[model samples]
Target: MKLETIDQVAVIGSGTMGSQIAMVCAIAGYRVVLNDIEESSLEKAKESLEGHMERWIKKERLTEQQVAEAFGRIVYSTFLNDLKDSDLVIEAVVEKLDVKRDIFEKLDQLLPEHAILATNSSTIVSSKIADATFRPVKVCNIHFFNPALVMELVEVVQGPHTSDETAQTAFQFVESIGKLPVLLKKEISGFVANRILGKLMDEALFLYENGYASHEEIDLVVTKALKHPIGPFALMDLTGLDVNYYVRQQRYEESGNEADRPAKTVEEKVNKGELGRKTGKGFYSYT
Candidate 1:
């Protein structure tokens, strides 16, 4: 499958990453289908995307006509079968391996043989993800940073059986959408960004749990002192404490080391249903 010639794209799981990816593709002149299990969530996602476009129009970044065209290019669906004609798919489903594996397996069965199956997984390796699916050669990781519509950098991780041509095509596709594409020679856990952030989060967890500083204090030091756009606490709140904790826990177990263990506090907050912005509270209050 040629990247430039790709006619249709599908974004599975219309949450933060999926919806934004669909918007980016639509804006880039590709017909996109954004699929989720729930119809209500799909409606909510369209509203959210419209709001995102409203901001762009307000800033003169996107004209009203452009906004209408972008929204018109997107098709929302509640089933995987809606992606039958899609030439490429970006799965931004839950971080759970089983959930991802099931989704890839279904796509493999339904999609064309040449379709590129990419995962937006931050930490999990693509090879393992491919092992669970039948389309190993077609599977690769196109890990986009948060705010996929704005973040310019994208990491393309190659699985063990991934064809060289497929990897190159992914880079071309990223460039088509005005994203910076960095290629990994091979697959690695976390791709790149999260691998770097994971270490900082580890140390930050120790500090917060050991009483070195409060969450607000920690956030202030990083964002104000280090000039980071956001600190770990703020990031956790934005990313959802439950989601962040799950990634950390998985990475820790994959590392097979006590040092990589997730912080007790992070886990406790998640267990209590304080899942950051989604729940209105985590380390900080959202409302």
Candidate 2:
């Protein structure tokens, strides 16, 4: 389908990424439906989105009137049927394969034949989920980095089953929403950015776990020497240790490589429910 044909965008799962994605689409003047299973989650997303837009206004990235108009274009819903009319559906659920496939199967039946289905998963490739749907050609990966409203780079992965038209349209849709898009010709578990970031994280965890250096010192070196905006440990915390842990777990499960398993420290943090800023503690504590 052509990019102009994508007039309505539906985001499944009203979590951090989903809500921000919906806001981004709405800000770009697309009719957006933000769907979640729970009404409480939708309410929280609404409040969090408003707060996020307020910060954008402070940064002069958006105006109050613009944010208001964007909000007006978004519809919050708990029913998946509400997405039947969507031109594109972006699934931003958890990193579980079965869960994603289940959602895709339902979406395949619910959405119109022409609707494009995309996932925001950073680690799980769309090929793993696409087979569950009849329209595998319409399914592709549209991964947005954490804090989607702030991050500029978005990865659009074209799985073997994904049609060229779908991949190109997904790339154009991302650009139309004012973010940079990189098209991946092949499907890899972590795509591009996260693959590089995953290597950095593995080394950082190795150093920290082996007592070569404190996480803080490693972070300091990364920021000062490597010139990275954030250290691997700090970035893990920002994106949630649980998310990192699950991504690693998924990789290990797929490859049967023990080395791909979650770091010892990250597993411990997830066990304790110290996910990240959301939990008030992860690699570091937050207020």
Q: Point to the candidate with the largest lDDT.
A: 2
lDDT digits (tens) for residues 122-236 of candidate 2: 8999989998999999999999998898899999999999999999999999999999999998999888888888899999999999999999999999999999999888898
Provide the overall lDDT of each model, using Cα atoms, as 2-decimal numbers. 0.86, 0.93
**Which tens-of-lDDT digit does each residue in 190-211 have in candidate 1?**
7778878877887788898899
Q: What is the lDDT of residue 10 in candidate 2?
A: 98
Candidate 1 lDDT (Cα, whole model)?
0.86
- Report how far off residue 111 is in candidate 1 (Å): 0.6
Residue 273 lDDT in model 1? 93
Model 1 CA lDDT for position 90? 94
